[model samples]
Target: MGPIRPTIADVARAAGVSRTTVSHALNGIGKVDPRTRERVVQAAAELGYRPSLRAQRLRSGQSRTIGLVSSMPVAVAGGPSKLGFFMEVAAAAAETAMLSGFALVVVPPLDTDPPLDALDIDGAIVIEPDQDDPTTKRLQSRGVPIVTIGPQQGMDLPHVDLRAPRVGRLLLEHLREQGARRIALLMGSGHRSWYVDLAEVYARFAREHDMPPLVVEADESGGEETGREACAELLEKHPDVDAICAAVDAFALGAVRAVAERGLRIPDDVRVATRYDGVRARTSTPTLTAVDLNLAQAAASAVELLLANLKGTEVPQVISNPDPRLVVRESTRRG
Candidate 1:
């Protein structure tokens, strides 16, 4: 027979704390003193004690399972930067959930009306939902927990969103500093918050600088063809434009093609940059400078927030992601 496993009581005794205190610390009930939580964690680790799944389920009436569902189609291979983002986020979420004795399921968008029958999850994280997103409504109607990566237009659920407006201003400011006088924006056609946020920032910057807002919208997921077509048109209309800000790496790569076809040297005749950073951007010609959204952190935070919600704990209505780093590469480095 297997040796007996340590229980929460054993951990509590080792840490010199009550079972209630141990439970609160282990379950992230919040308001526990930092030193106390650390001691409880150390004691639990030393004793190799994990909360029993059967007991936890019976007590909480939950499966201790979490779901991660992205609005964009996620792929393991042969997709764009956004797909890469989804996979990385999923990996992080799974790790975070497992540490808390929860199983993480990567769920695709549901086709039928009722999706709960498919799986019993305590909560889910939806990435980049639209205004009044139907998915959230349907899930809420069935009493499923949801935490979106980006905010829905009017939904009142907890969400974790990036500082998009700040990122937009930072990008424009970077381009302007690079001697890009006649800069053009390659934006997305979607009405998502990030897109709207960037457009508003671009318009405002144009107004303040007294320069025409050279903007063109494209299918963000159209890969190179969409970017190429959009860039070609932008160039055709504003031939003398000195810089282009592609919305994603796909568009940035296409812009590279379009610029080359017109005998333009990137960062010379025309500088280019993109929003999402990925392998494609790093490997592209003149390597596109892009935004590192810190998707992994965002994903982990979403899982934690959902856990808090499930526990009926009080958390902020809106959680803003505090980390976004800009990686400037060869594409926009004018030297």
Candidate 2:
């Protein structure tokens, strides 16, 4: 090496400040006087000091890395159509993390116990955690800062989630407005909180309207095939069913195929809607009437909340209730 690189200590000495003050000013971690911070920054720039990521992590006790964990197991499947919504959320989170100077790692769900110790993450963003999930439990036990995409069962962690119940109600009301007297719900077998909310709302709305509650369960993890099979079964059993509300776009796409195979006209013979809107919904034949979850905003909020928690700021128990936008399409438009 021709010349040794300048270090934080050298900058600190040049600025006549302690090493800790230099760190705070450079990282914007702790509170430092404005003049002192400016002096430290100017000295570091003049000295050409570039702090090492590893050394800063060691000093701050933070890995400067966050993890994106999902209970859905969508990443391993390589099925982009089935995981469009989640993939978008992950993409947004990754972009936000990068801008905030944090590296984002996607962690697969553990079949066995979660190896929390093996992950060198400062915190995690869990997507749609279920009740009593081992991963969530392990992270909680370790005192890890966690932000969930949806409300976690029995945990009061900060969460950024779409209003599932409201979305369900909106879909139901729209179907009824379109002259659908017999509406059926297609849902996943998993008991995630969002699923529960959707199911409960659908049932309650049906009861309130004096309509028969028809609910069908499908292998949510099985993607489009399961959705198609579930829709076929629903139609075969209830030929009078005029509307179908699927919890995901994959399921809605399946329903569209099922309807076409049955020689039924969309929005006339049958109407279809999905709770989660994604690329599949927008590109499907007749397109899909679905709810836009505003995944980008939710991802950004989750990253911001996690960053705040990491900075030792007191974050209130956040249950973000963002308004869901209903996108109308040919599938649900009558007249």
lDDT of 2 at 19: 97
| C-alpha TM-scores of all predictions | 0.77, 0.81
Q: Which of the numbered candidates is closest to the native, going by highest lDDT? A: 2
lDDT of 2 by residue, 1-335 (tens): 66799988899999999999998998898899999999999999999899997876888899989988877645222355445655677899999999999999877543444566788899999888877667777877787889998888678878886777888888999999999999999997777788899989988999998999999988866778888999999999999999999986778888899988999999899999987777787888998999888889999899999999899898775757579988989899987
Kindly give the stretch of ten consecutive residues in candidate 2 with the minimal lDDT sum: 73-82
Candidate 1 C-alpha lDDT tens digits along 190-240:
677777788899999999888898888777556677889999988887888
In order, what lDDT does every prediction score? 0.81, 0.84
Distance (Å) between predicted and true CA of 247, model 2?
A: 1.0
Supply candidate 1's per-residue lDDT for 298: 84
